[model samples]
Target: MRLLAAVDLGEGLESVVESARFLQEGLSIPAELLHVVPTPYFEALGRRFPHLRPGLEEALSQVEKEVQKTLADTGLRARVLRGFPAQVVAGEALKSRLVLLGQRGTGTLEALARGGLARYLLHRGEVPVLLLPRALKAVRRIAVGLDDSPASLSAFRVAEAWGRALGAEVFGLHLVSGQGGCCFPTYLDPETLGLADVLARAKAHLESLLKATGVVEVSKGDEELDLLRLAKAREADLLVLGSKAKSTWRHRLGRMVEVLSSQSSMPLLVVPEATVW
Candidate 1:
C-alpha cells in the first residue's frame, strides 16, 4: 500500500519524520513527503519582508533537506509538494491507502483552537488518517477497542489486517463503563441482573466476542483510563477506537467528542460506528 505523510515543519515535524520511517519499515509502504505552503497572503508577507523571510525560508529549507537526507539515509523515496496543507494532503490521500500527520501544530493558540490541519483532515478526509502521538518510540503491536457495533468490528478487522501484515500482536479491548446508560446494560437488566452480576455477564460477553475473533490477546476493562493504561502496559504501537453513531452536523460538533479527541495521546484510528463499509 502507498501512504502519504504531510510534513508541515511544525512542532511535531521530527515525530512525523520518525513515524514515516516506522511506517516504511513496518508496513513496507512507499511514503511521499508533502510540504504545504500557505496561501498567497502569508507567502507574500514572507517575501516582502526580505530579512524576516530569509530566516523562515532557511529554516524550512533545512527541514526539507533533513527530510530528504533521512529518506536517503534509510533508502526510502520521498516527494515534496507545495499548496494549502489540508487540501493538498487530502487530495494526495485520495490516491493513496492512508495518510499520516502529527497530533498538533506550531501555530498560535487561536489557530490551534480553530483546529490544526490534522484535525480537519480527520473530520473530512476520505482515507484513513493516522495521527501520530508526540511520544511514540516504536510500534510493537496494535490494539483495537471493540464494542458490539459494526464500526468497532470494522476497526478490529483493520487492526487485525495491519497486525498480520506487520507481524505484530493483535489485541482486542472492550471497555465496560459501569454507568448504567448504554444499550448493553439495558438489555442485561431484563435478565434480572444486579450490578455485580451485570459486570460478570458483560465479561462473559466480551470473552465470547474475542473467541469469535480468534484473537488470543483479549483484554476487558471498566474504564477508559484502564483501557489506555492496558495499551500502554502492553507497549501497543497503535490504538483503534470507534467514533460515535451518526448524527446531524450540529450534534456532531458537540462537546463529548471534542473532549475525547483532545485527550487521546496515541494514534487513534477512528472508524464511524454506523458506517456500512
Candidate 2:
C-alpha cells in the first residue's frame, strides 16, 4: 500500500512527517512526499527581463532544500510535482491509498482563497483523506461514528488497524433518534422503539461486530453532538467517520461528513466503504 503525504515546508511540516511516521511505524508501506510547484504568475516579466528567471529557479531550489532538510531525519522520499497545488493534490490522490495533508493548506493564494486548499482537495479527491492539524502526534484515542450500515462497519474495521498501530483504545458512539424532546416518526426514533430496547439492540450489534477484536466498549447517544462531545472530552486526536463514495440515494455522501469536514476542530479521517485501507 502507498501512503502519500502532502508535505509543506512551513509551520505544519511536522504534522506531515508525523502522519508518515504513524502509517510507517506499524505497516511497512511505501510512502511518498509530494510538493506541488505553482506556475509563476509573473510570466510576462520572464521574457522582458531574462535575469528574473534565474531568481525563480533559485527560489525553487531553496524550497526543495528546505523540504529536504525538514524530512532529513525522517525516512521519507520527496517528489516535487509542477502544477496548480490543489489540482495536483487531487490528481495524485488517485494513485495513493491514503493522502495526508496539513490543515488549511499552503501558499498565500490558497490560504487567502475561500475555504482553503484543504477544502478543495477534500471535495476533489476520491481516496481517503486525512487532514492533520499542527502539534498532533500518534493516534492515542479514536472515536468512530456508528450505525448498523455496512459503511459504518467498514469504518470500524479501519479503526481497528489504527488502534492496533498506535496501541490505542477505541470507543464508538451511535446516535439515537428523537433527542432533545423532538420526536420524529422514523424507525430510529427512541421514543417509538423505547430507549431500553434501542440500547439493547445497539449493544448486541456492537458485540456481534467487534466480537473478535474484544473491543466491546460502545455507547448509543441521542445526537451527533454526543459523539462530538465525547471526542473533545476524551481529547481524541482523530475522529473516524464512515462515508460511502456512491450511495443508491440521489445524493453522493450526505451532509453530516461534509459539515464535520468544514467545522471540526479535531482531525477528521474519512474511510469510504470502497476504500481498501
Candidate 3:
C-alpha cells in the first residue's frame, strides 16, 4: 500500500521522519515525504529572522532530501511536496492508501493542549490517518479499542486489515467503564444488566464481528487508565479509535477518540462513526 507521510515542518518533523522510516521498514509501504509551507504571517516571521529562517528551512529541506535518498538507497520510491500543510497533506492523502502524521510538538504541555497537526489530521482527514507519537519504538502488533458501536467496528476492520498486511498480531480490546463517577450516565450500570454480562456480551459481539478476519485476538478489559495505558502494556504499534460528532462541548472534549489521540504513545487510526462498510 502507498503510505503518505505528512511532514509538517513543525517541531514534530524529526519524529515524523522516524515514523515514516519505521513504517517503510516494518510494513514495506512506498512512502512519500510531504511538507507544507506556513501561511503569510509565519512567512513574514521567517523573513524577520533571516538566519534562523534559512537554517530552519535548510534543516527541513535536508529532511526531505534525506528521506528521498534513503528511499532511493533502499530501492523504494519517494516524493516531496511543498504548500499549505493541511491542504497539501489532504490532497496527497487522497492518493495514498493511508496517511501518517506525527503528534504536534516535542513539549509535554504542547502535546496536552489541542490544535496540533496530528490532532487536526485525526479529526479532519478523509482517509484513514495514523498519528505517530514521539516515542514509538517499533511496530510489532496493533491494538484496536472496540465498543458495540458501528464506528468501533469500522476501526476494528481497519486495524485488522493493517495487521494482516504487516503480518502483525491484532489485539481487540473492549473497555467497559463501570457506572458513574466521571463517565457518561448512559454508560453507567449497563441498564439493569450485570457488568459481567455486559462485558461478556460485548466480547461475544466482537467475536462474531471479527470471526471472518481470523487474524485478530479478542479480549475485554475495564476502562481505568484509558485505552492508551492498555495499548502501552501490550506494546501496541498502533491503536484504533472511533469518533462521532457531538453537540455538547464537554462530550466532544471527553470523547474517547480525542482522549486516546491526546494521550496515546502508539499511532492512532481513527474512523468516523458514520463511515459505511
**33: Cα error in model 1, Å:** 1.3
Q: What's model 3's lDDT at 27?
A: 66
Identify the runs in model 3 with alpha carbons over 4 angstroms from their true place: 8-11, 25-28, 42-82, 104-109, 112-114, 135-137, 180-191, 212-224, 245-254, 273-277
Whole-model Cα lDDT per candidate? 0.61, 0.67, 0.63
Q: Pick out the ten consecutive residues of candidate 3 with the lowest summed lDDT.
A: 180-189
lDDT of 3 by residue, 104-198 (tens): 54466877553465555555535677777673447578887765566767777777666766788877776666555333224335668776676
- Deviation from native of the Cα of residue 235 in model 2, angstroms: 5.1
Report lDDT (Cα) of residue 55, candidate 1.
75
Residue pairs in clash, model 1: none
Which parts of model 2 have CA positions greater than 4 angstroms off?
A: 40-75, 104-116, 179-191, 206-225, 248-251
For model 3 the local lDDT of residue 152 reads: 68
lDDT of 1 by residue, 1-277 (tens): 5777776556777787777777776777877766665545646778888667877777667756775665555344566655576777778777877777676533457336535665665566256667665734565688876666555566676777777667878777655454553223334663476556765665566557556634433333454556667777778878876554344365342222344355556776665444322
- Is 2 or 3 the stronger prediction by lDDT? 2
Best first by TM-score, ranked: 2, 1, 3
lDDT of 3 at 139: 57
- Candidate no. 3 TM-score: 0.71
Candidate 1 is scored at a TM of 0.72
Error of 1 at 223 (Å): 6.1
TM-scores across all candidates? 0.72, 0.76, 0.71
